[model samples]
Target: MIDFFLAHQRNPHFTGRSSILKDLKGALTEGGPAVLIGPDGMGKSAIAEEHGRVNVTEYDFRLWVRAWDATVLATDYAGLAEPFGIPHQEDSDLQDLASSIRTWLEENERWLLVFDDAPSPEVLEEYLPRPGSGGGGVIITSKSPGWDGDFAKIEVGPLDPSEAASFLLSLTGQEDAEASKKLAEALESLPLALELAGAYIGWTGVPISKYLDIYRKRLGEISGRTSGLPEALVAVADISTEQVRAVSQEGIDLLRLSAFLAAEDLPLDLLVKTSALLADSVEMGLMALDRRGLVRRDEEPLSVHPLIQALAYSRLDDGERKTWADETVRAIGGAFSTYLGDLSTWPECARLLPHALASSEKVEDLRMGSEPASLLLNQVGLYLHRRGDLAGARNVLERLVVLDERFYGRGHPEVATDLNNLGSVLRVLGDLRAAKGCFERALAIEEAQDAPDRLKIAIRANNLGTVLRSLGDLTGALAAFERALAIDREAYGPNHLKTAIRLNNRGEVLQEMGDLDGAKESYQLAFRVFEQFLGPGHHYTQRARENLDSLSQSESD
Candidate 1:
């Protein structure tokens, strides 16, 4: 009798599903076949296993079968026969084995059977005991919702938000109401996600706030090595994705794009832009995904569950991921502004930032220099830099340099541009020597070109001068600044913004060299140019005026 019951692990921290438990007990007590139907991570299997655990002594015999474990449901009776202690006979057919099992069950009184993770109604119907024929009951859990034919059906969903919050609190022994609520909301109240969150929190002793931060930043890595909760969530997602793919390849492609975007309120327009499918075909694909619970589209913008998104991303191979990433960048670039001057488009830009950042990181991993990759790197790098994410900016700019070098080779103008951008980030990070080296390399590249870009050469010289000054090399700094000023004056004339910038650079260098009179003259000239061309309210004009004022104040003192 002990051998008949399979050992099932119970959730130690399970909480708050009294109503479902009552319904499950009612169906089982009546000796009727019952099916628990729901999406993955809803605790359907847990409920079934819990009932089996509690009722282990009531039944004369009990058996558990993983119905989908076998390749051919029709031919695989081994899972069914195993609990009866029946060994496989090479000569016996599946029918004979199934018959022997049925005979054994018929001889037993008050027996129970559970078919966990049944793939579909048709697949399991033949294996199930005939309705009202058995002395005991049968319980099955499935991802399909339409498995209720001639059986009591219980639909399991996410735990109530309060219940989910309570569950987290109980598991972690935390008194934080707000953090628990936030964590529950972030996990979308899924049982598996909650369990994983609790396990991670308990193991790491991280506060709820820090856990949420790590969860967001490392979502794709959630299933890397952890067992139990993460594995369960990923298994469910894999089955769901395979089901969707079996129905429509378009659906699978859509799932890939959704993984790179925000999990909630994902804009369908953006999704459609990424796909090459016709609009109607895209609609059909989304419908297929919706039907499988891989994505939901009841609202205006479609959304995928966070766990599902993470699973989808983790499943892709490198090549397929690069292809999808390229498509994602192209789609977003079509809708969002790549040029930094487009401030009016900022609302949309802000909305796309999370997705863009994620996609840009994927593009960087490919290390290819395609147009879409370049666009993603350029925009994301600039955005991160402007937003004061200096580390993120450096990461993106460093990749951009690699990609530019690969695409255009050394000494190309694009490579020089990439190097200059990286140099700027390095300077801000206070790696003065490294920044100087980057700037010098960029200047050499610019100068080596047959039809050298005079403006770029001037910009690189100015940047190099700034780094040299930071390194306390006053002579090299002044020389570089002078060259920049001369180039800017020749290229764009004295009144241009570039020329004004170069003049300001020279003024700073002169001041650093103790040439107060020369510094004052340079500052005054730069201030006049900036004020006339850029207006007094402009940042450049204001900075130039401040420099001249400092010189006068020092003289008066």
Candidate 2:
């Protein structure tokens, strides 16, 4: 590989694929099976063949077979055996072929078998090692993510921003940083797409943006023969799908559905929930697709290449696109409604929020049932914090705060409602100190706003008191809880259900302060409120009963 690159030195035009070579190095040194999965024209084959030749340099034997061979010639054993100096026997039966190749492979101490553009699983499965035959490490490159082996699965995504820029500038003969950045952005940060655009620009002498506009208008044209290169990009996408379809039509549909997803990654649960297929079936099908290189597996989600997304979008006519968009919105609304309170459901809601907002009649229209849109956004912040997406969550919550203020007024109960929610997210993000400040600020805002709704004020006071308790300011927590209790009692009378919630909150604060007797009294009051308003067997009423018994027993002891 070094000699080849050195021989072609002066052609600094090879861009965005340096990492592919690096991965090849890691895989070869590790000495096991590896599957190189990437989109078309991103140089998967070039890196595999070149690096395999370089690394297995001193091996007793090396074998390379195009994946297409299995589809065409039914098997590659005869061709691969030649390198090991094994001659094909005339009138050899299937048993003879398997025995012959197994013996040859087992004999070689450090052999490398490179399967280039391997056939679909349907064709390749017939030729996969019978038990105990695949003794040595093998490397396979295909358009899809293949199965897990004892080795690694190196998925080659598009180039990082810097690599994409360097590649584009080198190819277009343009050294300007600004021009390259524009081109890179326009090409959607895809390596092959950028390379093709660069070749077109250099050949035609057109400006980068001009070509980008053409890309937007007619992306299909860019993949065809022109600029002295083969239509490699389109050919790769189509051929990979054709191969996948040969094995599983359902897998192809999964890939197509992946293209419909707006986010870069889709979680496993979302896949099962949104798709028509059963969870286990979808999981296996997607895993197969991952092996084939049509889709990729991220840590907790799966991704399709940007170029594949573009191609998928292009394939949809206007009506079909609209239908997909509308159906997606409806799915999102349903998910948000069912799973709003639970934190585990946040990612599902977050993934659906954008599509819902874009296609739904209005944001307000989607905020129905248990999980209203405003509360859904608040939950999104919590999930974002758990995922270490503080900046993103903060951005969304800040905008949500503004929306809340505009719709419900700065001091209105609805606005104060989200203020406490936002503060909770901020606290978990390691700013509990700052979060305490936000709660206090909201309390002040709520107190100043002239609303006749004392229940709203009680809610604000209770929430602020809770924040104070979490911040370890027990004295402040007690005072705020007392104020909330007083307001609730004045507005709804002592035994009202709302007052019971305030009593439970105050009991929690009293418990924090080590006042067991006061906490017991507070819990007793809350239990009575529940018994009167909610009756027995209700979830919250049961919770109140448990708290009362626990607090009373603690006081007795």
Candidate 3:
């Protein structure tokens, strides 16, 4: 049931935007003209095609027109008339052609006309049928938003985040909720970007995590030969960018800087730091960008859509990109605090995490070993680990370790810290051997110093003990725990959480070694300390209680 003189092919994996489709259908059913306006690559034409496909039976005659750059609307009628089997003469007078089209529409009981990719309202104004001239409706899709006179406007934005995520999962036949959501967010929930990503994944059999890596590395370059989305992301971006540049060069510059930062809630203060433009000029530049639909500006911060950010970054030359990327690193890095252990600062750190990761990548790419860059990597890596993104954590922390070792040598305190962090991830990942080696190397480096960090040594010993225990080296684990206990007792007192933790660890090794009475004594002491300092309901106290109970039951048996 497809009637097409010039209808664009529908998307096979088309998903979501039901409400917008409904609204377009409602307008069409009421016999009114509707315009779908949005930025390039937002699937405006696809929605129109889907609407036409679903409602093909409602119209007696259906016509599609490619109104983009159509200088003479009358001459284009021959192409429109071809589908309906209506005879047309190329040499006919323009008025006669118009009369013929009008007469056909009046005679037909119902008909649908879709003016796809209209360049402007003025261009389509001459071609639009008059009110009550036809029974069916007209639909138009355009990049330009100015569709004023007598057309019901539907602003086709990106799909909803949930819908976009579901579309990706369905397209790839994957059931990973986290990865789907992350992919959806990374692509900015744009339908074309999501489609391209899904196509790439399905074609290559790449996991969602690996696809995210490729997408982050080459967002603008990701494309496929999908039916409806013929143009690559970079090509669409180039078109929009050319339009923005035509309006203002400052807008282009603003977008380029935004490309190196996060896609959402970009701080104006951070932008001001990197930009040489005065506050007023920056505001005007943002206004120009906003007008072109390249960026969204709020009261405090500005944001560029994710796809726009990727496109903007892709447009930069190597030298100019390096300069802007460095500036972005400095701006975002300056704002981010390296001390992530402070619970009060976590919200701000989480807010900055995306930008921090972007800036850190730029820093790594340029091999610029500034303090801010180091701090950005360290904090973001730690934050990712805390957030339970183990793969992401491993990637950043591994890079941090390599960089630190290269810059400060293998024996540096920073290298040891990186090693300790990496070891923690390895332990959680169940690589006990690698984790043990990491802890050993960190402990060795720390102990070799004339004036070592006693606290660091104690923490490393505690980590090593746990890994050793997991490897079933009960004696070695017990020794490691005792060393940590001795250090913590001297450094933080016997009642401290660190000391209690070491005591509990030592008790676990003792039980494993079949010294049940010794384990019982150690657990009792640890439990009393935890209850006094952290309360009986604390996790540490409960663990000590369970360990003591287990040991007591074993002795009775």
Candidate 4:
């Protein structure tokens, strides 16, 4: 048995890849070539190196090449001359040496060649040995998912929890299962992250239990390794996005935007469509970033790792962070409107919802009062309210009120609008006093306006009356309802839908006050308006009809 050549030895600490090694062996035996494809730092290169280490005795000549790109692949091939003892002068043409090595590979049997971090299958095709000429095996590692039928594709994925925990315990030389499990889960059992965590602990001598606290405080430090550290983790990205930064700055811009949002299943369409940059440039930028494995551009959505987002975010200057945060808020706010919270817009709203909250949080954490954030929170509050998420609605509405006040002043109509919506959410949540307070503040703001908008005044009065009635303040409710009724009558005239809604609201208060005749008249008038304007089949019209029927039943009884 000949001693095979492998440039890097198998990692002494490599863990949990027996199944993958078996798959690699099977794939290499059956194929033109075997490619390990996945997101960057999922241990694709390590596995390939380990596969070579495991099969050392099976082959005569084994070559490990870091085929980063075409030029590097060629250089690696040329350098192979020295290892093979082929005569070559210092000024020998690299092409000639590569050609000679290609010839040698073609003529040999039981030989193995590995291209780690291959730039592309197209570039690699030029360097591989001719098919069916020799019993030689080849393996490749890449971030790209797409591969032609000529290669067998094996996916490198996250390590299982047990495997990850074991790796940590082994590396730290500790027997603490609980701490190891906690640490592994925090890192999501990602091999590269685990390796970095292990390396950090080994170097610092930090116990696994205390390591998590340090990790939280110094995330960038752990993700980007220390001096003289092996290159597994990165602070800015999985792969070098310097080219993306230089050429497709918009692509880097897209990544900056992604950093403030949810890390996984991020809607690709929203990011591309909402970007302020020209669509074509942004698209091209995304492709460039995708090619480098900086952004994991899957078929539907683009996902960023949490570590990627944290690093990208941490790298931004405060000014840059604010600009991008505001941009994110505007993107979500413009897409999500308070007017359309129906089934028609549900899917888009659902997709945009996480991003909206994420943006809101980012701005809030920075203590930056962005006016655009109010718009996003308002629509988010409304959507949550309509979706029967009352708690979520109240929480968002509360944030919106504070933001509106901060950005638009306490007496601004925007603040009134936020207060009104918050009151409605509070009312539904069974907090009558808090609901009444919100409604009262909203109405006071509206009434204090020098020339109040009549429609807005009516809405404020109407919401106040509803909440007042809920609090059992019949007299206060009646006055508020009358204020709304007078405003709507003068502003919209008698038969308008706005008057009808106010009339229906007044009717509810009158009935609660035991004024049967007044309540009946109001219901009849509301029913007439809804039937004439919205048609009898409309839910609002049917609701009024039901109001009348229930009132008649009460009178007959």
lDDT agreement with native, every candidate: 0.72, 0.59, 0.73, 0.75
Across 1-557, the per-residue lDDT of candidate 3 in tens digits comes to 32663324455677888999899988876777899999866878778878877877786666766565332233344345655556754333444555667667656656777786787888655567777776767888888877776789999988899999998987787888899999888778877667656755664477988877765655455454222332445543444456567767777777887877755567666557644532435666776666444664545546565567766766567777777766776777666756666666655655576677776676677665556566678877776666555656777788888767766888998889999999999998888899999999999999988899998999999999999999988788888999999999999887777888888888889888988888888898899999998888999999999997887688678
Q: RMSD, each candidate, Å?
A: 24.9, 18.5, 22.6, 21.2
Give the CA lDDT, 0 to 100, for residue 446 in model 2. 68
TM-score of each: 0.56, 0.41, 0.54, 0.57
The 10-residue segment with the lowest total lDDT in model 3: 69-78
What is the lDDT for 26 in model 2?
74
Ranking by lDDT: 4, 3, 1, 2
Best by lDDT: 4
Any idea what lDDT model 4 has? 0.75
The global Cα lDDT (0 to 1) of model 1 is 0.72
Per-residue lDDT for 1-557 in model 4, tens only?
Answer: 33223335455788888888899999888857889988766888779878877887787777877565343355456667776677875445555677788887777778788887776788776578877666878998888877777788888888889999998887777888999998888777888677656755654477988877655555455544433222334422332455467767777877888888865457656656775732544688777666555665545657665556766787688999888888888877878755663566665775677678888888887777887898788777776666555666788888888777777788998888888889888888889899889888988898899997878878888888887887788999889888889988998799999889988888888887889899999999999999998998999999888888989888999
> Cα deviation in Å at residue 48, candidate 1?
24
Residues 1-557, candidate 1, lDDT per residue (tens digit)?
64333344455677888788889889987767788888767878778867776777777666666554232232234345655667754333445566677766665666777786777777665566666566777888888777655778898999999999999998787888899998888778888777656755664477988777766655555556433335545543554456567778878877888776655456567657555532535777887776545665654656666567767777788887777777787777666676666656654654565566566656766675667767767786776566455666787788778777776787788878888998998999899888998999999998898998887888898899889988899999999999989988998887777877888888888887789989988888889888988898999999998998888888898
Off by over 4 Å in 4: 1-190, 194-251, 277-279, 282-293, 337-343, 527-557
Each candidate structure's count of clashing pairs: 0, 10, 0, 0
Candidate 2 wrong stretches, greater than 4 Å: 1-191, 194-395, 402-415, 427-431, 508-518, 530-557
